[model samples]
Target: MAGGYVVGVLTETDNLNDLARGIAAGWGMKEADIPRLAQSLGQPQLQAQLAQGLQDFSDDNATDFFVIKATGTGAQTRYRAYTAIQIWPDSAFPVTRNVAGSAAAPNTLRIFSDFQCPYCKQLWDTALPEWERQPNVYRTAHYQFPLDFHKNAFSAAEASECAGAQGKFWPYADVLFDQFSSWTRLDPKDVSGRFSTYAKTAGLDTAAFKTCLGQRTFKASVEAQYKAGVALGVRGTPTVFLNGIKLMDYRSAEEQAVVQAITSATPSAASIIDARVKSLR
Candidate 1:
């Protein structure tokens, strides 16, 4: 263990006691005590080791975990990593650019998306539109989150904002994702001009849109949105929130938690999403 955190390996089994005791064993304890872990178990180890413990993530809806800290590194095995998460209230993510439905709709979908990310493209082409069409179910707020590696994404965000200026943000966004492959193939320097062509196809005033794109009118807005996403623990494109509950990591072992949080309509949705997120982490 190092950096004020210790690691533990929980076994891939269904027994709840194994999960509890594995965590206890990590802290050099002989017996597993559930309350003891929540109190004070964050101990630094002299050297990290690969300790065996029990974990129950084998099933889709995992409700229990073994509390074991792995010490002494250099073992070939699955590792659990944790990211510090801050719970932000719903209002922190205001819907500045409403992509679909009304802001006053029952459920809100706040998305931090990048144009160049293929998954973002897939989300755009598939689930997003279906959600939008169900106006009563979801109202979307699209925020720019241009990954630094995607060289053209920042400018693409600015261009989308320019489209927003002309009241065609959603339609223009459609064109962007629809032609994702074509534009991504071009050199970054030529991407803007290509976006202007797309602006025309989306039925915007080409002259006005061209002027807006060339002047970089919405660059600051895009920058601010990206920074806000980063501040709110967004490490990748398409990080999402459903009515303010931050969704779980897409690449995590538990994929259903994220999906259920976004789609579940139960009245206790917030608490359910929070529990699911905690379980996944």
Candidate 2:
């Protein structure tokens, strides 16, 4: 088995306890900090196991290493690794669904999403809270980017927007996602009746909401968002942007880098690539 393994070490650590304290204080680093780690192991594999724990070490007190073996036939392969650091800025969030953070901690992270998309639901129900806790990091703005393939997306977005006009965009959006499985499964022509029920369940003025839906009152607003999404290079559902920059996919190392980048506020070039990559994942 002619192959190679990669290991990372923190230079300033004297012992395991020191390492633990450094991590707790957010001063400790990760394996990806090592240069060319991704080039050697591909990004998906890199993100999958970046936080490997050291099980056994010869000098436990003085040793701090994270090793990853590359299984292949290349005895003469050169070894290299690079680390990228990011800085996040503290700024006032001028816009958000809720204004809890100020310029000292900007809370704005705009999301371009389609209510009918499953991945969007996953992001909203799962990753959103993690980001939400960092109120100083970003305030989120939700936009409608209904996909054409989804029969009910436009209607659903308009409904949510109308709900927003009533001061309930978030709640309406939540309800839409909660009911997505049922609504998306229904036949397109038969969906309005179910949508009416959803609106009622979401605490909309059922009659007026139904009337608006029947007349497609908010359709133009939804279309406007669609046009805006196209102009911004959004081709699918669950597209996200931090400030004005598009985020990468969920499974990308770049995503993890963006997490660190957003948390810190100063985006390194590599971190920006990671953010955009996470969007694809």
Candidate 3:
């Protein structure tokens, strides 16, 4: 999408630059009406529906969003690539949600993940630690997005929040990702027992953590976090935003991406997004 308008689209675009050629022959609809446009372009036996609504870039008035969809055909599913030129405000990175670093830190690493997800675990086990080691460079926030198929995922997220209440969000999250195999295979009720064991490793007050978990103290907040991830166009777990530009599509996050973003003197993602937003104006 260029200048907030759908110039051209593809099922799987081979050359992104070619999309610009579309304006000379417009698709004949207001691009702002994303859903209608998306549906009309639906392919044979496949359809695109706006899965998530538009989300605000910040607390400010202007909004930036992606209209992504999953086209289903019986047992098969496909993802349609769509880009909407947009802005991101690091100031609105949801600090009050759940954070592992200083809210006011210079860089933001926002993650939406499911406890049962292997790639999420891979990111947590390797890349995340490096982000943390960079001293004052990053402020990481974790957003819960336990996919429905992962039955024990929500319970695990609630456990992490309970641990967070005791000032141990990162430590407890570490245990969950690191030891994913052991407890992930267990039933939902048994997952509670697993959380207690790791809560101890995270140095939490086990009894308090257990009580918090049992009472479902953070259930609503965890669910709300998942909803927020969806509204942000997160289609799967382990979706990350580095300085608020999505870090590749789902399951493609790599440590090298973080390394390059932090080391380069290139303008921050927020500034890049600001430029795109200005172009739309």
Instruction: Choose the strongest candidate by TM-score.
Output: 3
Against the true structure, what is each candidate's TM-score? 0.62, 0.54, 0.64
| Candidate 2, poorest ten consecutive residues by summed lDDT | 1-10
Give the poorly placed runs of model 3, Cα more than 4 Å off.
Answer: 1-84, 90-97, 102-104, 249-281
Clashing pairs in 3: none
Candidate 3 per-residue lDDT, tens place, 12-113, comes to: 322222222232123233445555444444433433232221223321222233333444443454443433333345554444446766656666778989
TM-score, cand. 2: 0.54
Against the unseen true structure, what C-alpha lDDT does each candidate score? 0.65, 0.55, 0.64
lDDT of 2 by residue, 170-227 (tens): 7677777887788888887888888778777778888887788788887877787777
Over 128-198, each residue of candidate 1 has an lDDT whose tens digit, in order, gives: 87777878767888999999898889888999999999999999999999999899878889998899999
Q: How far is each candidate from the true structure, as Cα RMSD in Å? A: 10.9, 14.0, 10.9
Error of 2 at 158 (Å): 1.1
TM-score-sorted candidate list, best first? 3, 1, 2
Clashes (backbone N, CA, C under 3 Å), per candidate, total: 17, 29, 0
